[model samples]
Target: MEALRAEHLDKRYGADETEVWALRDIGLVLRAGEIVALLGPSGAGKSTLIKVLGLVTRADHGDLWMNGERVLDDGAPVADVGELRRSHLGFVFQKANLIPFLSARQNVEIACEIGERFAPRARADELLDYLGVGHRGDALPNTLSGGEQQRVAIARALANAPSLILADEPTAALDKERGRAVMELFRRVAHEQGTAVRVVTHDHR
Candidate 1:
């Protein structure tokens, strides 16, 4: 089954004379349990695409289906976007962005808890353990290594038990080895949890 899919997506800034198009007629279908990377050169709409997929930015024209439900049509919100992003989607960014004062476990739990209260603690622990960061659960974000912090970010993204996970330049902050480790962790999550993973990256390697 397709966890997330888009058709004829477009995003634009301004109108008429000064119009600038960030994305034009983009479409993608991602099946659950699939790990796919979004690759393109700079200014190729990667950010625009991710923003559209993540429900942070609206498309000028398009349709979106998340886990087979239509949430967008012609770039407009079909349903409540706040609910859509909160319940059905997970995201990881370039930096781990874990709260510095929060423990690894707390950081994970808070993200999941903010929208949905159920299973927050359990989900946090499960993801941390799965990502091999359970041992560092109580450590503050600043206390963990860069790779470990990134792992915690991955775990946090999984804390919601989402059907789809979207990552933008997630590995850009890590070294070569750590970057691979982050990507592999995403793959494992997609396979084991039956979640669809879309990673937006500029790393050609």
Candidate 2:
């Protein structure tokens, strides 16, 4: 099933002499159970594409569809963006960005609460276990290793069973081995859970 589709996406910053086109005529399709890596150097608009597809930023012009439903047209939202995001979208970032005061499990549980899932605590525990971080669920973010932190982040992203996940440089802070492990985790999550994933990275490996 098609998880997301974007056509003729154009994004520009500023105007006139200082105008910069962040994205121009970009098109993309992501299917359920598929993982796509977007590679580019800094300033290549890779993050811009992610922001657009994730619905965090509006394109100057384009159409967007999620799960075969039209969500945006010509840079305008046709649906309730917040509802769509809460129901179908998930995001991970370079920093684990877990709440400093919350345990790994609480971090995930909070996301479940936001999505209005039943039994947030159980769902959080289940996702942590699935992500191989069950043992660390009670640990605070600062006490966890970088890799473990990312694992918790991933679990939080999956709390609501989103159809699509957007990750931006999720492993940039980790060593090669840890980075590869996180990437592999994403692939596993995509295949096993039938979630579409798009990862932005500078690494070509």
Local distance difference test scores for all models = 0.87, 0.93
Model 1 quality (TM-score): 0.94
Q: Per-residue error at 134 for model 2, in Å? A: 0.4
Per-candidate TM-score against the hidden true structure: 0.94, 0.98
For residues 1-205, could you state the per-residue lDDT of candidate 2 as single tens digits?
A: 9999999999999999999999999999999999999999999998899898888998999999999999989989999999988989999999999999999999999999999965898999899999899999899999999999999999988989999999999989999998999999999999999999999999877
What TM-score would candidate 2 get against the native? Answer: 0.98
Model 2: CA > 4 A from native: none
For model 1, how does the per-residue alpha-carbon lDDT over 1-205 read when each residue is reduced to its tens digit?
9998899888998889988898888888999999899898888888878888999987889999998899898878888889878877888999889998989999988987876755778888888888999999899988999999999988888776788889998988899999998888888898889988999999964
Model 1 is weakest, by summed lDDT over 10 consecutive residues, at 112-121
CA lDDT of 126 in candidate 2?
Answer: 90
Error of 2 at 44 (Å): 0.4
The lDDT of model 2 is 0.93
Q: Clashes in model 1: which pairs?
A: none
